[model samples]
Target: MNQANFDEARKAEANYHNELYSDHEILEPGTWMSKPVPIVMELLERILQHKDHVTVLDLGCGAGRNTIPLAVRLKGTNSRVVGIDLLEEAIEKLRENSNKYDVADVIEARKGDAEQVDILEDAYDYIAACGCLEHVSSEEAFIKVLERMKMGTRLGGIHCITMNTDIQEVERETGRALETLIELNLPTEKAFSILEEVYDGWNVLDRKTTLLSIDEEKYEKPSQFRCQSITFAVQKI
Candidate 1:
């Protein structure tokens, strides 16, 4: 994408999320924010087995869908889940939801681009980026973010990433294809290849790709979206 197109895409995405967060309540049924990603919860269970205190970074953590639950799980321990998002409304809702969930004390919510967020070396026990990498500016930026995530993780730590690949969208009424505004929309195989290349020496605890379809309204029009969803979990050796 050119600079202008990239900026437009980012703005659209930010506006979409801002409106979504403002309109919906946290954990409201029939929404993607209704529950934390299962893989993230599963990996947290594994992390708790061997460690008492943990630190986690949740990229693109919209409205504390995963961050709040992770904090609740790690309650009573010296653990924290730092959540970052590009939308201001998301961060506000995340704070409110964290308070409502009684996990505010353990959550650090920040508004920032996931691609540009700082990930200090050996800083996190777990890192999660769910449904977010496609919002990055480019494939190069995506890979750079992954490298930062890898370096930020502590040894024996876990990373769970879920992203949409090979996305297709169409107008529901006319059956005409619509442009997908995401920045890093790679094919499933290509995305996996990049993951494998970046995490070459890490232990692959889980990896899978599944096709999914969803009907929704976007840009005030009904649309259908299909994509290969990739779920990857790895442990740093």
Candidate 2:
């Protein structure tokens, strides 16, 4: 993606996250808001059940959207959660939420690109990358992240990841843009297809694809782009 598009995505992500967390409503099933609740609950429950106090690393943890809720639940545990994001603004929002929620001590938020998160490697018990990795410059770079993550995680750890799936309905513009990118060698299908190689040693605990509409009501304006979010979970065995 071009710098302008990249910047726009960052802005959109920040705006979306800010709105989602600042709201006080509990999302219920059968609604667009319910999309993340289930996955977050599953992640929270699994992390809490681990025998060892976890050292977590959340990749592309935009604006603490997932970090804060997860941190709130892990409050009493010995676990430590670190959220890392590529956008500086997203990091700022995370810090703001930490103070707003007063859980700064338990949740540490940092600004850095996950594609090169070298500071913490082979050091995490659970690593999560939600809706990330697809935007990497190249497929090889995307695969390289998993290799680094392996070195950073302990044996028998878990890696939870989510990304845009190959199957989706898109607006004419978005579809055209994606096709151009693919033609130029930015193979999103090829990129995510390598997940099998990246998590070769892990046990596939969850693997499913869900098709859902992007809640147009949730957005500030209507657009041609629609999306399908894919989620997968694996345990290092």
Candidate 3:
């Protein structure tokens, strides 16, 4: 996507997320933000085995779905989870949810674009970017973000990422193909190739791709969305 197209798509995606965050309550059943991602929780357990006090960075964290739970798990320890999202509504909701869950002290919610945010080198013990990397403005930005994630992580730390690749969408009413709109959409094979290249020499603890299909409303139209969802976890050597 060019800069103009990328800006438009980014605006639309941010608006969609802002509306969702405004309309639904966190942890409400049946919603995408209903609960913390199971794989992230499982990975945290593994991290706890090695370190008691941890610092984590959660890119594209929406309304604290995973961030709040992470903070709750790390509560009473010298641990912090920094959650960043592009939508202001998501950041606001995340702060509210964190306070509601009594994990506010451990969570720092910030509004920022994941691709543009500055990640300090060797600053984080665990970094997660669930369903968010594909929103980057371009393929180059996506790869750059991964490089930053790698640099931000401390030795022996883990990075968990989940993103949709090879997205396909069609309007339900007209049965016409629609642009996926999100930036940085890549083929499944190419996405993995980039990940392997960026994370070369790192220990790939887990990697898998699953085909997913869902019906949802997009750009004010009913649509069917399909993609290969990639979940990868790696540890810094």
Q: Quick one: best TM-score, which candidate?
A: 1
Give one digit per residue, the lDDT tens place, for model 3 in 113-165: 88889899999999999999999877888888899888899999999999999
Question: Model-by-model lDDT, in order?
Answer: 0.89, 0.64, 0.90
Worst 10 residues of 3 by lDDT: 213-222
At residue 233, give the lDDT of candidate 1.
Answer: 95
Candidate 2 local lDDT, 1-237, one digit each (tens): 666665555555556655654553222354343334366558657756755477788888876657777677677777788999877766777788777767787888888876777745568877788766755655667778878877788766777877765533234434332321210132345544687778776888777665545533223334333445566777778
Count residue pairs with overlapping backbones in model 1. Answer: 0
Between candidates 2 and 3, the one scoring higher on TM-score is 3
- In model 2, where do residues sit more than 4 Å from their true spots? 1-37, 167-192, 215-221
- Please give, for residues 1-237, the per-residue lDDT of candidate 1 as tens digits: 888887877876777778778888766697778888888999999998999999999999998888888999988898989999888888999999988989888999998987788889999999999998988988899999999999999999999999999998889889898888777789999999999999999999999988988876666688888899999999999
Order the candidate numbers by TM-score, best to worst: 1, 3, 2
What pairs collide in candidate 3? none
Q: At residue 113, give the lDDT of candidate 2.
A: 75
Whole-structure CA lDDT of model 3: 0.90
